[model samples]
Target: MPYDFNQQIIQEFRANRGKVGGPFEGARLLLLTTTGARSGVRRTVPLGYLNDEGGRMLVIASAGGAPHHPAWYHNLRADPRVTVETGVFTVEAEAAVLEGEERERLFARAVEADSGWADYQARSGRVLPVVALTPRSVSFPDLPEGASPPLHADRLDATLVPATSDDRAAVMAAIRSLLAGAPALGADVTPALAHTGGVPGVWVSAAGGSATGDGVTLYVHGGGFEHTQPALEPLMACRLSEATRRPAFKVEQRLAPVHPYPAALDDVVAVYRSLLEQGVPSDRVIVCGESSGGTLVLSALLALKEAGDPLPGAAVAISPLTDLTLSSRSLDVDDGRDVISRRVAEHVTAQYLAGAPADQAPQSPLHGDLSGLPPLLLVAGTAEVLLDDTRRFAAAASAAGAEVTLDLYEGMPHAFHASVMAQDPPAVAMTFLRRLADWVAGSRARGRRGC
Candidate 1:
């Protein structure tokens, strides 16, 4: 935890001068000065700002990709009254935590200001806190004086569907077909045949690419609980290989409904452990998955931690049905925009759990103790009903001191990343994957140099 002298300049500019030249340009910023929750002393930190149709300043409680909320965030939660300072002037305002539709709307605007926030949301398995700072009476310099602008509720974009069944044959078929297509190998894509022992058809596609360089994404696919073709997730896997230049592996784990719950999770754990045993270092692997595969990623991480295995570098969960209870508000609110409905999620959960409680940790990652897990990346469509699931998961992860990133695309449906081959949004997804791979590659290089 030693400080980097080079990073010190950037941090100093961010904290004191309020005009850091990297990553946050062209956007207005403010210094939120708050008394420390425990220290009882004043602490001031500059934050990226978001304003709705009204000029009210909105700031997310993202502590620069840290594992926990900054001390100032705790102070504000304890006392909502805080002071705001910008490049020119200061003002007094009240902090209001926005949730649900209001929270989502405000969050979208914040993403517009810093698209990288989508990565932060993906890293934290929790909804990044969105707090609006409204001046007591609008006499602030950041906003023109005497402007008591009319305020409107941030509208939830009307593009979510919440009621599709998980058993839709067309959706499942599409997933299978995508998996069946041969990967378009890149120059850096290194490959080796998957050896699954007597399991017959387990394939391992590994790509070693990450923005941080210290992370790798190990993926598992989902087809109900019993049937998933690991080869299907090649679109993402190959992209990782091209991006990180490391290795990205898609472990063909057993599926559910038939293989059910622990069967697939156990297989994933074995694959992760095998990688470490094979000399691939623990800090270099990140587990990733889509749908039930995302669930397997979470479950495997938990089990690994419990079994005293060294945790992987990080993880990514896309449209992960982390909660089997199907109790999130989005199941109803997003019913129209969702490709898979709550009924389907519930049915799949029941079949997977057989007779276990819906809120079991393996069944609902949101309810699990998320402390000590590696950083995570979460991607979901603003229109899909699982939006709430991602939001809630990110917030909880943040509260538990884990770094998380979330990307909520404007109006895509569920598993939209799967359709990247034939869709517009896939370009955005590729951009995200490339960034992720670069980060992981950097992390790996840093780790080797003992950084």
Candidate 2:
């Protein structure tokens, strides 16, 4: 009903797609992010806008009848590239300053719509500026034939297992035994903090590694977005930390059917932002996750990008559920072939979205603009129900001008990379680790953008 601060209103607007309560309720409002002319930093402000010709939107530099134009007006004039988050779509647009009769006609139209523009113009003494934001065409990249993972020789054989296990807990236990079966924690990583972070997680480091130096690994665990394995995730993090040479924070994000949609994603973002706030460099941080956690890693990147935050050095998504709508055709084609079925996917998505639109983002990372993200490594198995989900995302991200490495393990089922968790991990698992470590090392060697 009432708002105290701009950030408070902004939080509500972002959470509700630019909607706010009280006087601004039902008003034509949008959040605008522009590069500051003087500071060379991005500044986001909430503003009202009007529709224009050819689908362009007009935003006026009224400054609420102030003596000077708003800082955003100066910022946009210096850098015409602006990001507008309208309820309908969040997009990048080129801001064109209207002049002469065009500005007159638009100002007249705006005054007719609200009468406030005229008041602001009369009160300010100078003519107000009307900038038209025209969205540019985005060319998404298509993956080449070689970009797809090579099919495993035993791929069809891996599909013969039960489509879906009835004893879900038992299935989980079996997986835990296979993945985190103790297997003697290495002497290099003998010490591990039982818990850590702004979010619930475990702090694990190798003997040779720095706890708060160089880089940090933010590891998010997967559980179909409903289940959380507090006991097992640390071991997973240990595996990652050992492989990456970075102390890993294994995030225990909130689960669904209770705290759904943004709760888990919000936890992830908070943890990452907290790390940055603590003086950790963004280019040195690596965000990695598995299954739904992988989904969050990508989603958090999108959210952070939208908020004008710096991205990480690189990211890894192992068997990610990129599309929450579960529209991937592989879900049906690999129904009985993969370990999980279409029904399981539906339940996970329904509980996680909890009435949020599945087709939209940052709930569905694949649905969001993928540009400006850090280098990404997407690992999946050909036998997975989410094969296409991961593949399609890689293609899209690549097209969106992000560096992406799509690693496919032939014939391996969902989360085949977890084989690295096994005692005396299989060759495939070791191969995955070798590539992972190499990729991460390579990311560090390159510039923040992987140049």
Candidate 3:
């Protein structure tokens, strides 16, 4: 195709949101943008694509059988980072050149799907290269087309206190079983080591995320306040960055039995203050964390409010441990049904608290005043032992005059959103991310930058 011809099609496609008229009208296609391997200049070209069931876009580099691989192919071979405009939205993707059995199988399938691929291969006298573009972010709609947020989410009616018949050994057994199946969700992230407010951590970006952006999503990982998943934390942070559409700083806070009580909490607050000092608007920033990380998020809010510091626009806690007291009833009622029993909770709380009073405000965020805080999105599963931790926190935050949105997934275990880390994740996990995206947008719309 002539340079002028490709330019016209690009203009038409952009104007029509992925559609082109004349010979290409209504064809399934996407705009592929690749960096010139040598010159480092970006080039965009429209290509016919096939939807692979593994969540990848398949493009054949036949180049009309011209006996040489396409320029884009060589460009991607040098640098796999590519930008794809699917007309739904633009996202960053990593280009993987298919090879061996996977290549033969997909190429065969492409031929079966369209004889044009076979015709091109025959004319080229060389095997066509098949490339798969796996999006670095998990994109989802705000709820399914027919779905809607419930008007009210009533608390689960199960008993809070434990029964004498509950066996400790049985509870431990159940905890181990449930914890074993916890989804290891995460993304392919690029991380750079940095210190925010003198607190050491990594700035992470989802594979295709932009680090040069102004706003940031501050992410704190969950590890029961004592342990850390060094290898997996970056992956999780990457996903959060993608979900919120911002570069993320994954805090490496001090752990328990060593840097107990207020150490970790202080780290979160310090990093937040660093963002504000660096000129990132409070409203443009998002503080999101999971498990104990979520606990720190809420605690940080209370601390910030007490000190008259600015708060982020919004927050999301994915199954946080709000009460170090371990007094939530679901710890007993949902005991064996979920992972991590009362014993584990007690050990974690004792270690992190290290003689700090559990009834105090920041230590036990569930005990503090939650008034004048930013909009919050709390997610949990009904099958988790911390169900009540989520339930009680939502109830208290709402009662304390804070904005709250509790998204519950029934029959899901603790930290269920971790499942979204997989290449092809379950619907529930995608829904969690979609809901977060919508909630974040809504928070920005209302300008809920906290005081």
Using all chains and alpha carbons, the TM-scores for the candidates as numbered come to 0.57, 0.60, 0.58
lDDT of 1 by residue, 247-333 (tens): 566667766566766777778888777666556667767677888888878878788888899988777787888777787666776
Tens digits of per-residue lDDT, candidate 2, 215-265, equal 678899998999976656676787788778877877879899899989999
Candidate 3, 1-451: lDDT as tens digits: 6779889998987664455799987576788999999999999988988877535889999998889998999999999999887543354689999999999999999899789999999999999999999865321111121022122222111111111122323333443443455334344444432347999887776635443344788899988898987766766676777778778888999998889998999999999998787677787678888888999999998999999997787888888999887877668766776666777788889999999899888879888887777878888765678877886777666555566776656456677676555544556666677777766776667656621
Instruction: Report the candidate with higher TM-score, 1 versus 2.
Output: 2
Candidate 2 ranges beyond 4 A from true positions: 1-181, 184-197, 448-451
In order, candidate lDDTs are 0.61, 0.73, 0.73
In model 3, residue pairs whose N, Cα or C atoms come closer than 3 Å (at least 3 residues apart or on different chains), thus clashing, are: 160-329, 186-421
